[model samples]
Target: MITLAGKKALVLGIANNRSIAWAIAQAFHSAGAELAVNYLPDEKGRFEAKVRELTAPLAPAIFAPCDVRDDAQIAHLFETIASKWGRLDILVHCLAFGNKEDLQGPFTQIRRDGYSLAMEVSAFSLIALANRAVSLMPDGGSILTLTYIGSTRVMEGYGVMGPAKAALEANTRYLAAELGKQNVRVNAVSAGPIRTLAASGLGNIHEAIHKTEAASAIKRAVTQEEVANTALFLASDLASAITGQTIYVDCGFSIMGG
Candidate 1:
C-alpha cells in the first residue's frame, strides 16, 4: 500500500465538502497522513465546526485559520505549523480567487484592481506559501497546487482566470527548480472542470463543464476523487523523481485534438 503514515500535510482553500481541497484531505487521510486544514478568517469558526464534524472519527488535525492574502496571517500559519509539527511533509495550495465580473466579461475589459487581485490570489499565493514551507521541510517534501486547462487554451468565460492560471503554471516550474535543490518536489495538477464553490463564480460554468466532458476521451467529467488520487501520488515518496510537472487528471481532455 502507498501509505502516508506519519506524514503531515497542510491543506488550504477547503471552502466546503465538495471542494477539491477536501477531497485531497480525505485522500491523504485514507493514505495515513495526518491532516491539518486551513480556514479563511471570515469563516474560521464556521469551517472549524465543519471540519470537526467531518474529522471527528479520525481526529486528523486541528483546523487553523489562514487567510493567504494577508502576509501576517500566512506568517503565523507557518509559525504555528513549525511549533506544533516541528516540520511539514506536504503542502496543498488550493487557494484562488477572482472578481466575478472579470471572469464573465471580455478579458480586455478587466479592471486593474480585478486583474491584480486575480493574479495575487490565483497565482502569487502559491509562491508565498512555498517560500514559507521550504524552511519547515528539512527532510524534503512535496508541494502541490491546482490549475486548469485554461492556462494554455482559451475557454469561454474563463477570462482573466486563464492568464492567472498561466502564471501559476509558470510559478510551479520556477519554484520547482529552486526548491528541488533542497530535495523538495513541486508540481501542479491541472484538473477538469468540477462544480466547486470557486468555479461557481464563472458565468455559465455549466456550459464549460459540458464542453469539457464532450471533448474528453472518457466523455464524462472528472471527479474530485480522481484529482485527489493524482495529488496523493505526487505527494508520496514514490514520486520523488517527479517535479516541476503539471499532471492533468482530466480524462484526457487536455489532449484532445481538433
Candidate 2:
C-alpha cells in the first residue's frame, strides 16, 4: 500500500497527455500528494496551454512557468512554492533535451553548443532543482528524475542524449550522498522508450520502441503509468531506504543482452 497522503510534489517537464511527467502527476495526485506541475514558456503559450488541459483534472497545487535555462524563473518557482506550501516532500524532474541535429549525427560530431545545451537541461537541472527542494523540506524528502538505458548501454540514434543521461545518473548519486544526512533522498527512473514528445526527437524513435518491446522479457514496453507508479513508491515512505539509484522501469529490457 503506497500512499503519499499530505505529500507535496513538484513535477517538471510535463508536455502533454503522453508525457511521463503528466503520468507521474496523475499518479501522485491519485495517491493523495499535493502537486505542483511545470510547463515551459513558449512563443504563443502553446506548451503551457497543453499542460493546463492535460493536468486539469489533477488541479495541481501550483502551475508555474519554468524554463530551467533561466535562473530567475527557477528561483521564482521555488519562491512561489514556498509561499503556497511552505515545504515540499517530492520533486519529480522529467526534463531533458538535445538539439535535433545532435540526436542523429555521429556521436563524435556533436557540436560543443549542442552538447552543452543538452547537459544543461538534461543533467544540471536536477542539481538546480534539488538544491531548492532540500531547503523546503525541513524534515526530509525525495528527488526523482527520468533517464534511459542509453545512459549506459550504447543505442543507435540516441547520440548526445546518451552522455547527457549518463551525467544525470552520476549526479543523482552525488546529490543523494550529499542530501542523505539531511534525510533527503535523490533517485532517478530509467524508463524504456515511449512515444512521448521528447522521444519523438530521437532518430528512428518508433523503431527503438518496437525493438525494445521485442527484446524485453515481458515482450512489451512499459507504460508511462508504470513509471509513474514506481515514482509513487519512491516518493512514499516505502522507499526511504532507497537513494542515489537509477531504478529501471523498462519491462526488464535493461537487464537483457543480445
Candidate 3:
C-alpha cells in the first residue's frame, strides 16, 4: 500500500468532479495526504463555485482561485500554501486548453494566438507552477502533470494541442533533471482518451475513443480513476526512483504500430 500520510498535495485544474485532477485529489485524500486545490477564475464565478462544491467532500485545506496566465495569482497560491502547510509534498497539474476552432481545422491553419494560448496554458504553465512549488518543497517532492499520446503522435483533430503536449513532455524531462539533486521528481502521465469536459472541446473525441478501444491492447479506453491510481504511485515514495518520463495510461494504445 503506497501511502501519503503526512504529505501535503496541491492539485490544480480540477474543473469538476469528472476532471482527472479531481480523481487524483480523491486518491490523494484517501491515501491520507492533505490537499490544496485550485480553480481557474472566470468573470461569472461559476468555475469557482462549481470547483468548491466538487472538492467539498475532500475537505481541502486551501481552495483558491488561480489563473495560470497571471504570475501574481500563481505566486499567491504558493504563498498561501507556504503560510498554511509551510511545505508541499506533491503537485498535480491537470490543466490544458486549446481553442475549439484550432482543434477542428487543418493543423497548418491554426491561428497564432490560439497556438500561443494552447502552449501557454498547456505547456508553459507547468514550468511556472513548478517554479513556485519548488520553494515550498525544501525536503523534496513530486510534480505530476498530465500529457497525452498526441504529444508524440499526430492525432487528427488534436491540432495545436499536440505541439503543446510535446513541449510539456520536454519540460518534464528538463525539470526532472534540474530538480533531481533536491530529490524532487517531475513526470507526466499520458492518459488515454476519456469523456471529460476538457475532451468535449475536441471535435473528434468520440471517434478517437472508439478507435482507441478497437486498437488498444486492453480493448477499451481508460477511466479517470485508473489514471489517478498511476498518479498516486508516482506521487508516493514507491516511485522515488522514477522521474523525467511520460508514463502512458492509454490502455496500450501508444504501443500499437498501426
Poorest stretch of ten by lDDT in candidate 2: 197-206
For residues 229-257, write the lDDT of model 3, one tens digit per residue.
99999999999999999999999999987
Point to the candidate with the largest lDDT: 3
**lDDT (Cα, 0-100) at 133 in candidate 3:** 93
What residue pairs clash in candidate 3, if any at all? none
Instruction: Assess the local accuracy of residue 228 in candidate 1 as a C-alpha lDDT between 0 and 100.
Output: 95
Candidate 3 residue 79 Cα shift, in angstroms, is 0.7
List runs of model 1 lying over 4 Å from the truth: 43-48, 55-58
Give the residue spans of candidate 2 off by over 4 A: none
230 Cα displacement, candidate 1 (Å): 0.3
Note the Cα lDDT for every prediction shown: 0.90, 0.92, 0.94
Candidate 1 lDDT by residue in tens digits, 1-258: 678999999988877788999899989999999888877765347766775676566565656788878999999989988888999999999988888889888788999999999999999999999999999999999999999999999888888899999999999999999999999999999999999888898867788789878989999999999999999999999999999999999999989996
Q: Please give the lDDT score at residue 189 for candidate 1.
A: 99
TM-scores for the candidates = 0.96, 0.98, 0.99
Score candidate 2 by lDDT. Answer: 0.92
- List, residue by residue over 134-181, the lDDT tens digit for candidate 2: 999999999999999999988988899999999999999999999999
Q: Which ten residues in a row have the lowest lDDT in candidate 1?
A: 54-63
Candidate 1: residue pairs that collide: none
